[model samples]
Target: MLIQILLILGFVLVFAITWRRFGQNVITFREASLWSFLWLSGVAFTLYPGLTERLASFFGVGRGVDLILYLAVAIQFFLIFKLFILNEQSERKITNLVEREALSHLNEDEPASANRPSNYESNG
Candidate 1:
């Protein structure tokens, strides 16, 4: 009972924090909603562990704990994949910006005529 209370309190605290971040504009409404749902689900599961057990059995899992573990791992992998894609996109944007800036500076340093092909006849 004490553990349940503690877990519920922890989930509520996180839920509050998540909303606070949303209020502060640190996170978008969609992000806050997702986090809120996750925290609330945590609280719900903690309050009624039998729900997890039933779900576990329904899914053919041996135990509720195992189901939770499997779900946590799956979510972690999904988040990691998202971060990886975001990182790759950021890298590409940075590279393109750097290339554009370098080219612009190079153009600024040289005369415009230097960038154009000369009309001189080809030497045999």
Candidate 2:
């Protein structure tokens, strides 16, 4: 249980920092909120195995614990998928930005000074 708390806290801290940094153009608030929910839910589910088992049985799962864990895994996977999508979006944006910059540099005239070696080159 303690371990779960620490892990959850760690994830939340990292998420907060990442969300703040990438939140600008990376993910919408709604998406982030859902992402957070999925992660936190998994953490909560993992920590309370007994409760999860009971809930699972209540829902017709033969083994409540196993069912709960499986559900948690599924939920976690979904969140990870969403996170990956956001990550891909950011990566593509970066790729596009870099490509645009490179193209612009290619299209524009080079600075006149860059075309020739400096006077120091002759001295060497």
Candidate 3:
């Protein structure tokens, strides 16, 4: 009973944080909604573990704990993939910005005539 209470408290705290983040504009509404759903689901499962067992059997999983572990791993992998994609995109944008800034600086340091074609013909 104490553990269940603790788990519920933890889930509520996390749910509050999710909403707070959304309120502070640190996270989007969609993200907050998803997180809220997850935390609420956690609370539900903690309050009634039998639900998980029923779900597990329904899904052909041998045990409720096993189902939770499988889901946790899957969610972790999905989030990791999302982070990887975001990191790659950020790197690409940073590289492009750096290249552009370098080229602009180079142009600024050079004389205007340096970028133009020469009009004089070469004598044979």
Best by TM-score: 3
| Candidate 1 C-alpha lDDT tens digits along 1-124 | 9999999999999999999999999999999999999999899999999999999999999999999999999999999999999999999999888876775565347775676533434232
**Models ranked on lDDT:** 3, 1, 2
Q: Cα deviation of 98 in candidate 2 (Å)? A: 1.0
Residue 70 Cα positional deviation in candidate 1, in Å, after optimal superposition = 0.4
For 23-107, candidate 2 gives per-residue lDDT tens digits of: 6868777877776776676666667667776787788887866776678799789889999999999999998888767755552
Worst 10 residues of 1 by lDDT: 115-124
* Over 4 Å off, model 3: 105-124
TM for every model, in the order presented, reads: 0.82, 0.45, 0.83
RMSD for each model, in Å, please? 6.7, 11.3, 7.2
Clashes of 3: 0
lDDT of 3 by residue, 1-124 (tens): 9999999999999999999999999999999999999999999999999999999999999999999999999999999999999999999999888876775566447786677443435331
* Local distance difference test scores for all models: 0.89, 0.72, 0.90
TM-score of 1: 0.82
> Which number leads on lDDT?
3
